[model samples]
Target: MWDERVPVHVAGDFYDLDAFRTRPDVLRDFETAEVGDVTGRTLLHLQCHIGTDTLSWAHRGAARVVGLDFSAPAVEAARALAAGLGHGPERAAFVTGDVYDAAQSVPEASYDIVYTGLGALCWLPDIRRWAETAASLVAPGGFLYLAEFHPVTESLDDATGTRIVRDYFARDAQVWDEPGTYADPDAETVHNRSVQWQHTLGDVVSALAATGLHIEFLHEHDVSVFPRFENFEVRGGYHRFPDGHPRIPLIYSLKATKG
Candidate 1:
């Protein structure tokens, strides 16, 4: 599913590589502040779609950055992008593999920061395994940083406008057969049928804690990097609900350190 969406994203406004070529620091503002002082950090980005965020980290002063993805096309594109940006393979490298499987593929306990998710966790079925992989990748004193769509926010029915419809604590992967990619809703579609899971806020926190990662802070916000529902307003270079809409936590961020 992700493989087919690569070209669409590459050409779309969401992952604008043309703009990226001119501007190396295209990371979202909050992300820049949260993943602070990457000056000499070895950062690893898992489920990294096409390495924009990975390269963004590299540009922010990460000494070494690796982007891991399940899609071969995305990895190839990411490598090309990093090379084009002149970071090349020395500073920025991309690997094609499932995030869960990359624990063995990438040198374990090597990275200073393990990063994942803007819209990543939903695609995975096991938070337990995800936490373990993140924990294993970061060295002692290093941390796992994540910013994701809130499960509560995701559970609402956007198809018929915002309303509670889906299970917030669903234990199984939900099947989606919708056409079109998120980047281009009108484009010709491929691999429309995909599976996604829902993880509650509690589940996410517990999974990392169980892996022995100490929670630094868990912050929630009403804005997101993309419009997740109908009629959401774009503000501060992100998306949020208008003043009168039902207020809910649309995004959540957490930084957990490995002891």
Candidate 2:
């Protein structure tokens, strides 16, 4: 499914590769501030689609950045984009592999910062295994940082997000058969079936804690990266509910350090 969507996403206006080429900072202001400076750090980005966020870290002066994804086409796109941005293989590398096998798949054994970007966790079935695998790649004294859409939204109505229509603690996998990608909703395409699982904020934190990672912070925000709810308005590069509308945690970020 992800393999077929790579081309569409790369050419779509949602990503805007042309704009990114000129100004390659796609990261949110709060995310950069939360992750702090990466002047000389070695970072690894898991589930890195097209390497935009991965290369963004390199743009921020990270000594080395590597991106790993399950889709081969996405990896190729990322490598091409990195080269186009004047980043060499040594400075920014991309690998094609699964997130569960990331430790063995990546060129480096470990990194100073192990990052999992937004919309990544939902694709994984086992949060515990993900934490264990991701935590293993974090060098001692290093940390694993994840920014994801809040699971609470899954329980709310898709349109208005005002009422709950699903179980909040449901452990079953939710399958989606919708056509078109999030980048281009009107686009015509196949391979639309997707299986996803919801992991609550508690599930994510506890899973990392089970791997002996110290939870540094778990911060929730009212804004989202995409227009999750119909009532959401674009504000300062983020989506939020309009005035008089109730606010909910649309996204969250967590940083866990290995002892």
By TM-score, who's the top model here?
2
Model 2: per-residue Cα lDDT over 1-259, one tens digit each:
9989999999989999999999898998878999999999999999999999999999999999999999999999999999999999999999999899998899999999999999999999999999999999999999999999999999999888999999989889899998899999888888989999988888989999999999999999999988898888988888889988989899899899987
Worst 10 residues of 2 by lDDT: 230-239
Candidate 1 residue lDDT tens string, 1-259? 8888898999898777899888877676776788789998899999888888889888888999999999999999999898898886878988888888887776444689999868899889988999888888888889999999888876688842467887776787689898788888887876899998888999999999999989999988778877778778887787878878777888889999988
TM-score of each: 0.94, 0.98
Candidate maximizing lDDT: 2
Candidate 2 residue 168 C-alpha distance from true site, Å: 0.9
Model 2: pairs clashing at backbone N, Cα or C within 3 Å:
none
lDDT comparing candidate 1 with the true structure: 0.85
Give the RMSD in angstroms, all C-alphas superposed, for model 2. 0.9
Model 2, stretches more than 4 Å misplaced? none
